[model samples]
Target: MGKVTGFLEHQRVKETYQPAEARLRHYQEFVSTLPVLDARTQAARCMDCGIPFCNNGCPVNNIIPDFNDLVYRDDWKSAIDVLHSTNNFPEFTGRICPAPCEAACTLNFNNEPVGIKSIERSIIDRAWEEGWVVPQPPAVNTGRRVAVIGSGPAGLAAAQQLARAGHDVTVFEKNDRVGGLLRYGIPDFKLEKTSIDRRVRQMEQEGVTFRTGVLVGDWPVGSRVGNLSTETVSPERLRTEFDAVLLAGGAEQPRDLPVPGRELDGVHFAMEFLPQQNRVNAGDRLERQIHAAGKHVIVIGGGDTGSDCMGTSHRHGAASVTQFELLPQPPEQEHKPLSWPYWPQKLRTSSSHEEGGAREFAIGTKEFIGENGRVTGIRTVRLAWEGGRMTEVEGSEQVLPADLVLLAMGFVSPVGSVLEAFGVARDPRGNAQASTEEEGGYVTNVPGVFAAGDMRRGQSLVVWAIREGRQAARAVDEFLMGQSALPR
Candidate 1:
């Protein structure tokens, strides 16, 4: 700890955001990082508990206390070193991660936790500015080649670790650009593309090859999700050429509402709507897009993707925006006593929620009403929950006007075709079948094939994806070399 009584002396500080009105006008990042002094004060609030549940709370298992203390002492170089020891991409997590580490802080037992996410962002930002972030190319090439199937955080993290461990690594992204969902799925306002591009440059310098617009296996035909691949490489070719193959592709199959009007013209998946704007922002002109401008938009499923749809709609000057959640609203405040050292369910109001949109809870859409084959309204009903069972409230059906409807429900699994192409086993939940605790962790039933990240764990946070990637790299390194210096 920087001060003997720093936690008692300072209150938790949050990063300031640009006004909703101002931020809604553009798609650039709006949240400002804390100044150095304020960030130090925030770091001082870390109790550096004896157990440090924050380490386990974070998916990457970052050395939280050490970095916090370093930041408090103004030793940013050491802070970045501590941060990089476990995490390959703090900037990605610092911006978008929900910060489970903060929730697990012992301070949350009675008071606000340390601003770990903001302090983390500060450290990485300063490191990038001071040129501390550089390619760590392996001193000697082990001459083992590994092929990573996705360019998301998981694949990127694994590729970096494998490269550093002297393996020749190549990442295949089906999309036209690197960074997979990070470059396409996430809105630019929350994370700029430059954040990902800079890392790609570094990874290239580290001797990792990136093949964009290239698919490693057959993509599902007629699929609307992530269908930008122009070239295909059979898994057989990859297996024959590479020493090991890692499946780090994300779960891209968005869940659907199989209701009466799901096939209506205006009804679309959130993945369909969100990526178009991201492409437009990247200077790619789409002749036609799922435009929300001057239209009544109803986003079903209250999650990050839904919030992203709402924010994009706002930027598109939609006439109105509304979001729906099937479950009843969570409590406004978390009961820290029972939930201490673990994540608690509570209402989270994102910056997009503050951008002027109505939210409906405990409601389910029954059908989409349309006119001339275009969605004109939606039929919805309120729900009543008891004893973990859900029932529709009687006489609760109502019609709400909508020109565009986005299904923001979560993903169910990775594309089945990709897994089938490689003959990798899938779990009961449709994710790739693999074990993390057993020997040869991350290995699939098929030899030389491994799975990690969302492809193995289903939908998850970026931090979790990175963790899976790093751990999977260790497993692959071990399999290849009979021993691995890579940390799990």
Candidate 2:
């Protein structure tokens, strides 16, 4: 602990952001960093708890208390080293992760967590500026080859770990660029593509080969999600060419709102709309692009993706924005005494929500109203939950004007064709079937093939994906060499 009474001496300080009006004008990161002095002061607030719940709260089990002490002691280099010890991408998580670690903070009993996320973001940003982060190429090659499918967080984390362990690692991405969802699905404002590009460069220098626009399994010809690859590499080729294969392809199957008029032209999946803006920002030319300009937009779903859609639409000059949630709105604050050491149920108002929008909870869409094949409005009904079941309320029918509708419902599973091509069995929920147990962790039914991340664990946070990737890398290394030095 930095100071025995630091928690009482200091209060949590949050990262600041540009004014909503100014940030809405461009798709660039607007969150400002805390000054070095303030960061240290905040870090000093970490308590000397006998059992640090923050460590357990983090998916990758980041050594939170140690790093906090390091930062508070002005040991900048060591602070970053401690931060990087567990998390492969603190910058990514710092900006986008919900910071479950803070929720699990020992101080959260009173609802004021240690501002761990802000400190994490500060450490990484300063580390980059100070030139501390660099490639760590292995001293000797193990002569083992590994192929990682999907370039998302999980795949990237696995490939980086495997390469550092002296294995030849190659990552295959269907998109034209690296950084899976980091590259395209997330808006540039939250996480810039340059961050990913810089990391890719470092990975390349560390001997990780990336092959973009190369599909590793059977994707139906001409079928496209956010983006598609023209070239296809069969699963057999990968299984034969590489000693081991790890599938980290994320769940891409979006759940559809199957109400009436679902086939209208203006209705689109959130992925479809999110990636186009990213592509356009990257200087790629799309003959046609989805726009919210001068349109009243309705985003269905109340999760992070829906918030993203809300932000993007505002950037596109949408006339109005509204978000709908099927479940009732949670309380404004969590019952801290009962939920001190876990993620609590409560209302979450994102920065995007503060920008501008209306949010309706306990509501369900009844139908899409369209005019000449284009969505014009949405009909909805109020819902009441009784004994864990939702039932429609009488005399609650309503219709709202909607020039554009984006379905932000979460994904269900990985694409069936991709899994089928590898002949990897899937769990009942449609994720690649695999266990996280020590004896046979991440191993698919097929020999020499493993699965991790959303492909195996279903849709989850980026932090969880990194954890899965790191663990899976150890599993693969052990399977190939009978023992491994890689961290789980």
Candidate 3:
């Protein structure tokens, strides 16, 4: 505790954002950092709970209380050290994570959780500015080689840890550049590419070899979601060359809405539309770029991916935008008494929602109405929940004009080709079958083969991916050697 009664004396404060009008004009980060003094005050608001649920709430199990105290005392270097001890990339989580930690805070029982997210962001930003973040090269070589597929958060975390453990680590990515989804799936407005590039540079210094445009699976050009093809690399070559192989490819099998007129020209998946904009933002020439200008856009699904499409459409000057959700709208506020210290079911209005968009809840799409094979409108019907089952209400049908339709419903599972090629057993849910127990954890049916992150588990947050990667690395280290010193 930096201050004994700081939590009682101070109130929680969050970081501010730039004006909507100004921020929408460019694909750059718009979040403004809090003043140093204000950040310290916010950090001081962390109470001394007998049990810190915030630590438990965090997927990476970050030492929240210790970092909060360090920030409160202006020991930013030490704060970043504590944060990096658990999380490999605090900047990424600080910006994009939903911060379940706040919900698990003791104060959240009254809906007044401490500003853990903002304090975390501040600690990392200060660390970078002060040049405290550096590479940690291994002191000795283990004379072993490991191959990691996919350069996303999970793959990067595993590769870095294995490299620091004196194992030769190599990352293979299909994209021309590293960062599988973070490079293309996300927009620059939320996270700039420089953050990834900087870390890549550091990882290089740490002796991690990254081979971009080296696809490990057999896929044709323009077939791997958004006209990006994988670089040809045989699985036989990897197995023969590396001591161990870890598959960290994310769950990329997007759930498609295969309804009437689904093959229309104007209708596309969120993955197709999102990656094009990301490529353009990265200064690549995109032939026949998809734009929402002067069009009435309807985004199907009401999750983070859908919100991202809404924001991108607004930036493209869409004449009108609407988001649809099949489920009923949750209450604006959750009953804290009933859902204390756990993620509650509540209405979440994202920053993109604040910009502009019509949100429809309890509505189900009946069909996609089109003209001459181009999407023109969407026919929908109101829905009601009865006995835990949803049913369409008769005589509540309507049609909304839509020049463009984007399917933003989440992903189903990882692409089966890679897993099948490797002959790894899959769970009932279509993910790689692997336990997290101490024995046989993260080990695939194939010897010397391990799985982690979205590839092993289903779709999840970036923080969870990092945690899985770290744990998987430890498992691999233990399997290679009798005992390991890596953190789990």
Q: Cα deviation of 394 in candidate 2 (Å)? A: 0.2
RMSD of 3: 1.4
Residue-level lDDT tens digits of model 2 in 5-87: 88898888888899999999999999998889989999988998889999999999999999889988989899999988898
The lDDT per prediction is: 0.93, 0.92, 0.89
List the candidates' TM-scores in order: 0.98, 0.98, 0.98
Per-residue lDDT tens digits for candidate 3, residues 1-488, read: 54667878988787999999998898899997777898899888888787999999999999999998998899888899999999999999988899999999987887488888888888888888989999999999999999998898999999999999999999998788888788888888888989999999999999999998776765554455346565667677888999889999899999998888888888988988998898998889987998999999999999999999999999999999999999999999999989878999999998899999899999999899998889999999999998889999999999999999999999889989889878889999899988898484899998888999999999899889999999998888888876789998
lDDT of 1: 0.93
Model 2 ranges off by over 4 Å? 219-229, 438-440
Candidate structures ordered by lDDT, highest first: 1, 2, 3
The TM-score obtained by model 2 is: 0.98
Ranking by TM-score: 2, 1, 3
Error of 3 at 87 (Å): 0.2
Off by over 4 Å in 1: 219-229
Whole-model lDDT, model 2: 0.92
Off by over 4 Å in 3: 218-230, 438-440
